[model samples]
Target chain A: MSTHARPRIGEQHCQECLVSIGPERIREEFPTLWTKVHGKPLVYLDNAATTQKPRSVIEALTRYYTEENSNVHRGVHLLSQVATQAYESGRTKVRQFVNAAHDREIIFTRGTTEGINLVAQTYGRRALRAGDEVLISAMEHHSNIVPWQMICEEKGAALKVIPMNDAGELLLEEYRRLLTDRTKLVAVTHVSNALGTVNPIQDVIALAHGRGIPVLVDGAQAVSHMPVDVRELDCDFYAFSGHKLFGPTGIGILYGKAYLLEAMPPYQGGGDMISAVTFEKTIYNTLPYKFEAGTPHIAGVIGLAAAIEYVERVGRNQIAAYEADLLAYGTEILTAVPGLRLIGTARDKAGVLSFVLDGIHAHDVGTILDLEGVAVRAGHHCAMPVMKRFGLPATARASLAFYNTRADLDALAKGLHKVREVFA
Target chain B: MSDLRELYQQVILDHYKRPRNFKKLDGATRQAEGNNPLCGDQITVYLHMDGDLIRDISFEGAGCAISQSAASLMTTVLKGKTKAEAGALFEKFHEMVTGGENAVDPMELGKLAVFCGVKEFPVRVKCASLPWHTMRAALEGQNGSVSTE
Candidate 1:
């Protein structure tokens, strides 16, 4: 009889665990066993949906409510002064995070949805004329598409869509052909939430600028994954959600050029966003305040600043490198599954893997995976045009973040095998 | 290992795999297309009626298991029934799928009883109800471009 040697426990470990193995080690080392004392450690593969809040961000929220809890820009007490300073400091941090030129150019709103709506109502309704064209890509989320449609309908302007290939990459040739003298604005996503394709925004912005057309890049999915320099890209408008970037919900930033913002009308009429309010007429406040209507999410803004600081401390480049490595590994393992077809395979991609099995519904696959405690997003992912172009009803998408491990990929692969078995 | 067994019960899977009257009629009176954009599920329902009675009913499209099965079961049940009866049956099925307390007519529902399991999954309820909604739109004499968000 041949005897096989038994390996010792904890002999092999991940490099990331070796580097940052303080409390996180205790969390990951015995996930199931530790759930008795600590709560269940959720294997969150739904980063594309929303990210898990880190300890620093949670602490920041608690600290702000405990220490500097007061309304900003209204009161005249010591606590109010500290609160106002903290709020301004949060704005400055946002300006630096995206490398914006001026702090006044950043406007805080409810989220990316509200930001897009603000641009549509203010800039789009005012500038676009009859027969003017507003260009958007086929892979846009409903938030990016519906706002433009609403404004175009009211302004009597035409809405044109840039076609995308099967790989989910925007057809640059078709995009160039669509750009005409009547093209007023081109709105595109910086990164696709469904396909994970990172669009080449610099080239897209330059192309739009050549035609004297402004561009709005939806950075809701891209800001947390990669470094975004608004000045370097020279996009006229950029919007992102704080919750998607490891911060709290109900807060987002819209970065716009100072000249265009000044040229546009105010989005809403309110108390704080007014220079003077008379019975006959009202004068709007300066640059960003004209767009911000009411009281904002103060705790959310402070938490977002802390999230940005955490990202900077960990280094965006290092995080991107680790994510790239994980994507490569995940692709290799997922492709090995029999009768599995990946939906989007663009060369320039993020850490998203969307696929469909030969004989199973995406919902069935999702249900089976959920039983194994591995969460993933299924269905069109709010991109119906992309699904129509690809001849698919729905797809299962597995999006990865920097905190994901190779073990997570293995678990996903194992769950996929069970899906195949169920459908075989 | 059959998808019909795991997701759908035996009756619904059988109806989906070999659907009854699953073809376009020579002269269809009422036709409508229903879409569920959230899942990219689309179906075009055709009804050939004589007076108030449904002579033949059919559907043609590609969708998920729940949708296809629901379409198949709906066409089978409505083929020989009157338009009023079909509309009443639609209400019953809708009630059952949406978890309402209204009593379901089991004979009218037939194989569609398997789809009652979908009520537990809120997202799949739209898939199962697409065919009924499309039929309602066609009977109301509307143009065939109905969407369930």
Candidate 2:
């Protein structure tokens, strides 16, 4: 096991504390944001889908291939050792990023989907029995819902849902009622990708803990928006994708508690997971390496560490404050549009502004918005149940990041006006 | 906004707002449902056949302006055509929207020519072609539904 790390520099000495970083400076960091679409300046509002990578992160990926390109954890050569230290440094960064208990608790996987699937197949398959239930909220992304369903079906266990209100906020009362003795696990999202509702996961964990049930948080949408202390949340398993955090794709972290990960079996069989291999028998490796099989995404891990460093330098609190204001301004501008109804109106929300305009399909709105060089997501958003709850097939979602300015929102409003004009 | 104007022509917008035959057919001889899961678009084509000819054609579904308008225009043109004629027309329409080589003349398509703009927007080709696929399925006695994955 390696050392559990802290942020590279203390928060008090951070540059954001001394001087406020405006959106203009932040925008310059992301090269893609400067490009034009359809002969118009791009207004990227699809942060929920995936964020634009900063120059630092892009450079990090390129640097790894150009400078230190070697397989990790196996080589005794100098280049291999350098690459191994960098890869392990990435793990330590992720450990500190989520504020997990140990470096070994952070297992790098493909993305959030794989992270949840790991827990579902290993922990869920082990704990669940013939009559057991795996409780999840209605607002969960398909990644969180499907894995448990697969495990439940195989184990002859039932999959249950905790209902939510029209506001897109989960019903704590219903959740309490549903948390029965037979529920083996509780999985929920920290922030809804489609709805943007910031669930009270602290209280959710407490409620589940009251009944001695462990909670797993789908933090894919939360990690970039706000400060996520897995220790503070007391969640047993926390999963998130690096791409959504402005990192490289195909890399993500699953931070499981030391005890829980130690008890759970390896999800996949291959090279790194085993301590010794023979025809007769084999012993599994330590905590995280036990779960990580095959050649891991070393470059992705290095890129993810660079992304973490970039975000930390920008300051999480500043990002949260900036985006909160953007969300409020966006809500005000969109609500004023006639025949437009906001889908997720949770009092506590983050990043997303999902809506539907009357007499215009979401695809049409997305098309019109694209014509104006404003990018957004217009589909089920992989949250079909949430769409059904709102009685909509799809919604046009404009998700915000710290780099977005009020001018971007103005462009969105202008594009929406164009949609109305065209449809009218 | 020249491209936008060509894509969302007044005819398409009008049909989208007040689609013709946007209801379930009562005495339809054959029907098939089509779904574009990417955009959550669903369409059901209902055909009333009289021996070899399609006596009536209708569609009931919800989708983008291109899809709904394309279906509405399809119902109007194929009213009394034979299944073979409709199939040929569908092929021409498909070629027009996909910008195929040796594309059918726009004048030959008449009101259906409005969908020519769909060629510029490749992602929406499925939307324009979904109802036609469903209509083909209905004519061929395909059971259950079709998905434009």
Candidate 3:
């Protein structure tokens, strides 16, 4: 604790509020944003793919491997115990962050991809029968789509999609109609990683629940942008990755309902996930351990905990508000560009701006922008369905974060002008 | 830098704007579609092969300037060349774009020399070589699409 760590009355939203003493200030804590590319300041607007880590999270990772490096669980040594405590602390942080009912419900997997696969393999493998349907929306990332597809294919079940409008919003009536007794599961994204469409998960969950169906919400793009209380959302399962939230990669959380997790079989059977094993018989461990099969990514988990702390300290509400303002500013400027067409114009959106310019390919736009030291992602964004729906080969996406300012958006607009000039 | 300017030379831009042989060949003996799925660069190579000689060549697709121009320039140079000669030229051109600048003379490449500067950008090497790979695939009488991963 430092003398300047405490937040004053109105300062509760910026930098420090809950910390007893000196917590690092929000943007100042991140040093990567100040990096220079090709003699220009790096204006990184590609936060959707992955986020830059803060000093605290980086330090936590280094501290873990440097000081308390040991295997977790079933160790009597001090280093192992400390490592185990740190790892379990990370799980507790996730449980609190998502407000899951039980700590045992928080399972740490590799990332969102593995988390989705874990659920799809364990729950979906058992739940889905032949001719059953797994309902999903049109705007889901490949992660949410492929896992269910794999399980459905294996189980002889069909994968059904709830189509979206041209504005990129999911049709609730279509979703409702798609929900049938044979619909084993509903998987939808809390936010579209490609379009930034914030889905109505509450209504989605309620509708699915009325039919006694479980819904899995992919919060990989939602958690960092806004506060997410899974208990409040009442989603049966929620999954998200650590790196997307400013933590290291190779770590993620899967929060499943206690009863559902208990009823489902273990995703993987290994040392940590087993109570006892023999040549003839094997008993599985408890909820969280049953899914986490191997020695987990200890440093990544610790870093994730620090990242969660960092986001909480900065205040998710403030992040949501700041990015909302950035989105509005970006939309206004980008839509006003001479020949630019904004792709995803959902009524409610955040963190993404995808568009196309007349007579210019998205890759060329990306290259020219890169020359100007602006990093924007130009591709299908792993949501090829979204691109196909919009009848575009690809799109230039400039996703924003809390660290971005009006100057960054202005630079993006200026870069578009340069792209226009280059083509002309 | 001079390298970036050279990579996007005026001639390359012109060819990109008005590609030389961007049409479906009437009597095509061989054809193959290729795509770089990452950037959505798609091209269909149509080869009018008279026995072993490529009497005419054409392409149709949408890609970045470097890819489209490289493909356009390839079609112009490969016309009337024997299949063996085309393969030999592909090797030389690939070496020029992906190899060291001093390894091959730009004057030896003629109009295709503009793409020699693409070697400065390791990522753009694929963009410059994608059409060549697809051409090689088509000359081999293959029907599958090629990908520059």
Candidate 4:
């Protein structure tokens, strides 16, 4: 309700300080020289999709490829041994990052899509029976929804969706009503990608557990934006991508309770997944590696470890606070535009702001913003069910991260004005 | 204003505000529903055919300006054309959208030429071509349901 405060202009400080952040300092501190060379000051607000790589993550990637490049978990050569140590150490770091109960529970995956598919193929194939139900929310991204659909189709399991209210908050009463004896698993996003609604995941998990239903929290959107401790939440399974969390692509983390992970079938079959293989007989390895069959993304895993370390140094609490403030700032400035409608207004929300201007198509808005050197995602955001629920075709989404500033929102505001002028 | 004018030509906005042949054809002989699931754009193309000629054409749907206007323009152009001619027009329009050379002159396309700018926006080309694709499907005797999910 406070009047929009003008952000401090042209300040420089260490990554620790709030008051001394400047463009030049950020460019010098981060490895964004390639972006800077293009004669554009990029204002990236699509963090819900993926975060920009910092200098440390890029350097770590380079260091792994140049200095420690070798196949891991095999051979007695020194390079192979160092690579194996770094890769395994990266696994330990991931376990700590999400506070998984054991390192054995952290299975390296090819980002969130593969992580969920691994669960669906392994656990869903074994545990789910015909007439049993997998309850997912209406706000799930395509990655979360389609995998469950495939599993349900194969197993004759019914997929039930938990609906949301107009404010983009999940209808708790409806969810409770939908949870019957047939409910086998409840897979939900920790944060809604389209609506920015930070779901009450702890309560959701507790309720499902009370009913003897396991829950998988898709932390693809939540992990980077907030502090996530899987042990405290007591979720049976959690999945998130490294790219979304400022790490390299082709790497993700799937956290499951050690017992459940050990019980599930191997997702893929190849070299590292087996203790020994013969023409007639084969023995499977232990947890984590049972699901990870092929040679993993070693450099990507090391880079993810570096990214997690960077996040810890910055502190999740500080990052969350900064992002929250930016979200509020962005929301105020954006909603001030005449005839501008903010689509998602959940009481508990993340930094995503999906909205529509009365007379402008979201694509047009996105195109104009791109020309102005501001990037935001526009469309159903892979959550077509959410758009259908609100009777909207598409909405422009400006999702923030720790790196975004109030000036970015100001540029967005200016861009919206241009949209209005063009449409008018 | 002039730069924005390039993207949204006056004719395009005019068709969007008051689309031609923008009505349902009850008991229509050929009908198809086209959907761009990415944006939730839906259009139902209705054609009342007399032998091989499209005696009447109309559409009813909800979508962004580009899609709605494209549908309106498609209906207007195909209303009196034969099924074969309409199919050829569809091919030409498809080529124009996907950046292939087409024989249809820009000026001859009338208000439909307003979509020429859509070629530049690779993402929105789907929006501008949804109705034409649906109409082609209907003329080919396919059921009235197609979705770009």
- Which predicted model would earn the best lDDT? 2
lDDT (tens digit, per residue) of candidate 1 on B53-118: 989889887767678888888988788898789888888899888878875655556666777677
lDDT of 1 at A40: 25
- Tens-digit lDDT string for candidate 4 (A393-415): 89999998777778889988988
- Point to the candidate with the largest TM-score: 2
Off by over 4 Å in 1: A1-42, A177-180, B1-7, B27-32, B48-55, B77-92, B102-111, B135-149
* Separate DockQ for every predicted complex: 0.36, 0.88, 0.64, 0.47
Q: iRMS values in order, in angstroms? A: 4.1, 0.6, 1.6, 2.3
lDDT of 1 by residue, A1-424 (tens): 1022432112232223322533344233223322321122345577888876665677788888998899888889998888888888999999999999998999998899898999998999888999998999989998999999999998899999999888889999899999999999999999999889999889899999998899999999898888999999999999999998888999999999999999999888886799888899988899777887877788999999988876665556666777788889989999999989998898888879999988677876776676566788888888877787888888999997766788888989998998775544
RMSD, one per candidate, in order: 6.7, 3.7, 2.9, 5.1
lDDT of 3 by residue, A1-424 (tens): 2225644223455543323222224556678987888778899999999999987788898898899999999799999999999999999999999999899999998888888998899899989999999999999999999999999999999999999999999999999999999999999999999999999999999999999999999999999999999989999999999999999999999999999999999887788999999999999998789888889999999999999987877778877887898899999999889999998888989899999998888988887788788999988999999899998989999998787788899999999998887778
Docking class of 4: acceptable
Predicted candidate 2 versus true structure: per-residue lDDT over A259-378, tens digit per residue: 999999999999989999899999999988999999999999999998998888888887888888889999999999989999999999999999999989999999989999999999
Query: Over the stretch B1-149, how does candidate 2's per-residue lDDT look in tens digits?
Result: 99999999999898888888878888999999999998889999999999989998889998788888989999989999999999999999999999999778988888899998999999999999999999999999999999999
Off by over 4 Å in 2: A1-13, A17-19
- 1 or 3: which has the higher TM-score? 3
Q: What lDDT score belongs to each candidate, Candidate 1 first? A: 0.82, 0.92, 0.89, 0.85
Ranking, TM-score, top scorer first: 2, 3, 4, 1
Give every candidate's TM-score on chain A. Answer: 0.91, 0.96, 0.95, 0.94
Best by DockQ: 2
How is the predicted docking of candidate 3 categorized under the CAPRI scheme? Answer: medium
